[model samples]
Target: MRKFLCTCLLFLLLSVPLDAQELDIFGYFEPQFNLIYLDDNYYQLQSNKLRVDLKSNLGENLEFGANFDWIVYHGKREWNYWNFIPERVTSRYSSARMWRYRFTFDDRSFLDNAYLRFSFPSFDLMVGKQQISLGTGYAWNPTDIFNVKDLSDPTYEQPGHNAIRVDWPLRAGFSLLALYSPESDWESSGKLLRLKGRWQHFDFSITGTETEWGVTDYEYPFVNLFTSHKRRLLGGDFAGELLGLGVWGETAYNFVGDFEDFWELLIGGDYTFDSELYLMLEFYHHSLAKSDYRDYGLNDWLRFFYQEQKSLTRDQVYCLIQYPLTDLLKIGGSTLLSLSDGSIALVPTVLYSFHENIEFTLIGNINIGKEGKAYGSSQGHSLLLRSLVYF
Candidate 1:
C-alpha cells in the first residue's frame, strides 16, 4: 500500500508543470419527493441535497479533485425497517478508513470522490476512489463487475471503488486497461484487466476480474459481514448495428471457490423513429438462480439481504419507450417482466425542461404479480417528483 501511494505521488510530481490555471469549484442542489403504496400501506421519502466540487490543476498533465455531498431526508413508513450498518454488500471489513459521516435519521454527509489523475497523449492513469462503469446492457450489466447497480433505479451512481487504473490505446480501435483495488488485507483486494477492440461494425471487449467477497450476517446469522471466499470472473461484451437496429450483448462466467460455476447473460436491441421516438427491448438470464424457486419464505429474502444471492429469477425481460411530445415536455416508460414467476413491474415517467439548467420529473411505479411471485410482492404503486438545479 505504501508503494502504491508513493507511485501516485511520484507521477503527480513529474507530470505537473510550473504554470497552471486556478482551481475550479462548482456543484448543484437537488430536491426530490417520493410516495409509495405497498399492501395498502403508505411510505414516503423527501430528500434535499447540496453537492460541492473542487478541481485544481497540479500542472498541465496532473490534477487534483474532490467532491462532497450533504443531504437531509425525511419520511414515514408503515412498517419497521431492517438492514442496519452501512454498505453491507460491497464494503470490505478490512478497509483503510471509514470515509463517511451520517445520521441516518435525517441528515447525512460524505465525501463522494477524491482522486489524482495524470493524462498523456497516449495513455492515462488515475488513482483514488472513482466509478468504474463498463458494459453495454441497459437494464442488466453482466460485464460490469465493478458496478452492480440496482435494476429498479438503474441510472443512479452507486458508491465508487478505491483503485488505481491505467488505460492505454493499442490502436485506433483497440485499447486495454488494468486496475487494482487494494484493501487492508491484501488477500481480499480486487484486480482486473480488460482488452477492447473492433471488428467490422461491431465493438467488443473481454475482461478478467479477481474478487474476494466477505460473508455478511445474513449468511451466518450469528456472524457479521466479514467472512467471504475468492472468486474469478471472465466476461465479454459486444455492440453494433444489426438489421437496422442497435444490438448489444454481455455475458459473464463466474468461478467460485468451491461451488459450481455459473453464468449470466444479457441481449438487447433498440430502434429510433425519425430521431424523435425510441424503443428498446432486452432479455437477461442468470444461470445461478433456480428456474423454479417458488419457496418465497423469509429465508429467501434473507439470502438476498445478506448478499448470499443474486437475482431470484433465472429469466427476465425488459422493454422501454421514450418520445418527446413537445419542445419542453418528454415522456418515457419501461416494463420489467420476470419470466420465472410471471411478474411484471411498470414505471412511467415524464420530464419537463423549463430552462437549459433546470428540469422537473414525475415518475410512477406499479407492480403486478402472484402472491408468491417476484413482482407479485412489491410496494404496489409509487409516485415521485424530482427537481434539479445547476450552477
Candidate 2:
C-alpha cells in the first residue's frame, strides 16, 4: 500500500508541468516561548511549528492542493499534567509533540467568486480534507465545529475536517449546503451528516450524528440558528455605519435513546469608531448534557467519556478593542470573564507588516482561575510568535 501511494504521488509531481498547470507554494512558521506561573512554581517551555501548502492548478476548472504540518515541543510541560504523569507522587517533567498532514481537491484553489464559477452554475462541490467553519461567532458551532480541538483549554490551533460537501444556490439570495463525514475522531468517534440553508441574514442547519457514547451507542440530532444584519439604525457620523446587531444560537436533542440534551446561545456585534479603531462585545451561554454510560457498563468508550467529562452550564462575556498604530502596525486585546465559575482570562496580540506579502504576529494568553477549576492547570500562561509569507 505504501509503495502504491508513493508511486501515485511521483506520477502527479512528474505530470504537473506536462499538463500545463500553475504551481503555487505558501506556508508559515511559528516558534513560541512560554512562561507559566502557578501559585507555587513556574514552568518554562518552548515549541516550534511549520506548515506548508502546495497547489497545482489545471486550467478549465480543475485543481489539487496538499498541506503538510510539523510541530515540535521541548522543555518542561504543564497543563493537562495528568495525561503525562501516572503517579500522584511523581513530579516528572515531560516533552510533548505531534504532527499531521493532509491533501484536498477542489474546483478552484483560491479567491472563489460567483463570476468564476461555470461548471455548475447553481451548485458547488468540495471534497477531501479541508477546514469548515459553520457559524458567525468565533467559537460556537453546535452543528459543525470540525476544527475545535479543546474546549476547557482554548488554543489558537484551529480544527480541520475530512469530508465531502455539496452546495446548491437557491433563488433570491438563498443557498443550501449538505455535508457528510465517514469519520470524526474529535467528537468521540462519530459519523455525521448535515444539511444547512441560508437566506438573507438568517441561517439554519440540522445534523444527525451517530457515535459511541458508552457500551451503548446512540445518535443525536442538533439544530443551529444564526441571524445577522449590517444596517444603519441610528444617526450621527455612525449613521451610514452598521447599527444593527447579530445573534447565533443552537440546541440539540438525543434520538434513539433517552439522555440529557445540550444548547448554546450567543449575541454580539461590532462597531467601528473609525477606519483604524473598533470595539466588539459578545455574550455566550452553554448548557451541556451529562452522560451516564459509566453507570451502565464498564466499556472502553464509556470509560473514555468519563475521563474526558466536561461541565454542564457555563456563561462567558467578552470584549475586544483593536487599533492600528500605523499603516504597517496593528494591536488588539481581549478579555473573557466566566460568569458561572467567576474566572477571568486575557489575550493580547500585535501584528506588523514588512511588505505586501511578509507579516509578523505575536500573541499571548493567560488564565487566572482557582486550582481544580475548569480553567485551572499547571500551565498558566502561553505565548506564540508567527511569521508568514504569502504569494
Candidate 3:
C-alpha cells in the first residue's frame, strides 16, 4: 500500500502543468495519531489521509473535474484488529499491530454534471449533480430524504449523491426549487423528488423519497414523505454579529407507511461577541412513533430498545464555544448532554494552519461516567491529533 501510494503521488507531480493557464491541481493530506489512557493502561492509534482534486475548462459553459482519496491506518501490534465491535470492548489490546487501506475515485464518473444556461430576463434552468442541504441541525433531516449519514460508528464516512435540480425566480421575493435523483448502485443510495418555494421571509418544502436497504440478504423497500417550514424571527438575519439575538426554527416529520414513523425538531441560534469569539445554543428532539421489529424478526421492540437505550428521554442538548487567536490558530469546544439519562460528554479541539495546503488538528473527547451510569463518573477519554497537506 505504501509503495502504491508513493507511485501515485509521483505520477500526479509529474503530470502538473508547466505553465500557469492550462489546468489546475489542488489537494490536501491529513495524518492523525490517537492515545487513550484507561485503567492504568495506554493504547495508541495512527491514521493517514490524502485527497486530490483536478479541474480544467472544456469550452463555453463546460468544465471537467476529478477527485480521489486515499486512507491508511496503523497501530500497536495485533492482527485482524480493524474489525471493530461495539460495546463489547472499550479499548484495544496493548500488543495489536494492524494495517488497513482504502481508496476512493470520483470523476463525477458515470454521468458528469454538464449544463447550459441562457440569460433571459429573470429565470434559468440547471441540469446536473448540484449540491443542496436542508434543515438547521448538526445532523437532522426529515426533508433531506436522500443520502443520510451512518453515524453509529466513527470509522464509516458517508458521501453525497448525484441529482438534477432546478431554480426559478419569480416576482418580488419569491422563488422555487425542484430536484430529483434517479436510483443508482451507489453507497448509501436513495431516490428523491422534491419541491420547495419561498415567499417573503418564510420558506416551505414538501418531498417524497424511495429507499432500499443497503444490507445484503435483508434488503427491503420503503417510502417516505417529508415537509418543513422555516422563518427568521426578531432580526434581519439569523447569523453574524448582530446584537446576539435571532431565532430560527424548523420541524420535520416522516411517514413510512406500515414500517415506522420518525420525526425531529430543531431550534437554535448563535451570538458573536466579536469577530473572534462566539457562543451557540441548540435544542433538538427526535422520536420514533413505532418500532419495526417484526420486519426483521425481532422478538420484542422494547427488549431491543432497553438493551440500546442510553438516554433518559428522546431529546438532546448541545452547547458550543469558539475562539480564534490568529488567522492560523483557533480553538473550539462543545458538550453533548442527554436530558433524559443525564449522561454528558465534552469535546475540545485545536487547529493550526501551517500553510495554504497543510494543516494539523488536535482533539480530545471525555466521557463523564460509566457506560450506562446515570451521572458523570465511570467515563473514558480519548485524544487524537491529525495533520494534512494538499497539492
Please give, for residues 1-391, the per-residue lDDT of candidate 2 as tens digits: 2244346545655765765767678776666666656545666767666667777654455456666676677676424433311122122222221011111221123321111111366676655555665545543444433433233223354534555567777775445656654443534434554455554556655555555343222111121122211111110000012336434555444332334344555566677675758777766665542222111221222222333212322666667777999988999877776666565667787889988877887777777644323333422666656666555
Q: lDDT of all predictions, in order shown?
A: 0.75, 0.49, 0.47
Off by over 4 Å in 1: 1-19, 77-106, 215-226, 297-299, 303-310
Model 2 segments beyond 4 Å from truth? Answer: 1-17, 77-80, 83-122, 149-159, 184-242, 246-259, 289-313, 375-379, 389-391
Candidate 1's residue-wise lDDT over 1-391, tens digit each?
A: 7467657765765656646646689888889899977656777888998888888888778777767889988785223212222233224333322222112445779877778888989998988877788888887788676666565567877666788899999987899999999887767789889999999999999989888754344323333344567878999999999889999999999887865577899999999999789999999998876566454433344444344555667899989888999989999988988888788988898989989889998888877665456565443678889898877
List TM-score per model, in order: 0.85, 0.66, 0.63
Over 223-330, each residue of candidate 3 has an lDDT whose tens digit, in order, gives 112222121111011212334454455566655444445565666667778685877766666564222211212112221222221222356666777788788898
Candidate 2 Cα deviation (angstroms), residue 28 = 1.7
- The predictions' CA RMSDs to the true structure, in order, are 6.3, 11.1, 10.4
Better of 1 and 2 by lDDT: 1
lDDT of model 3, residue 178:
54
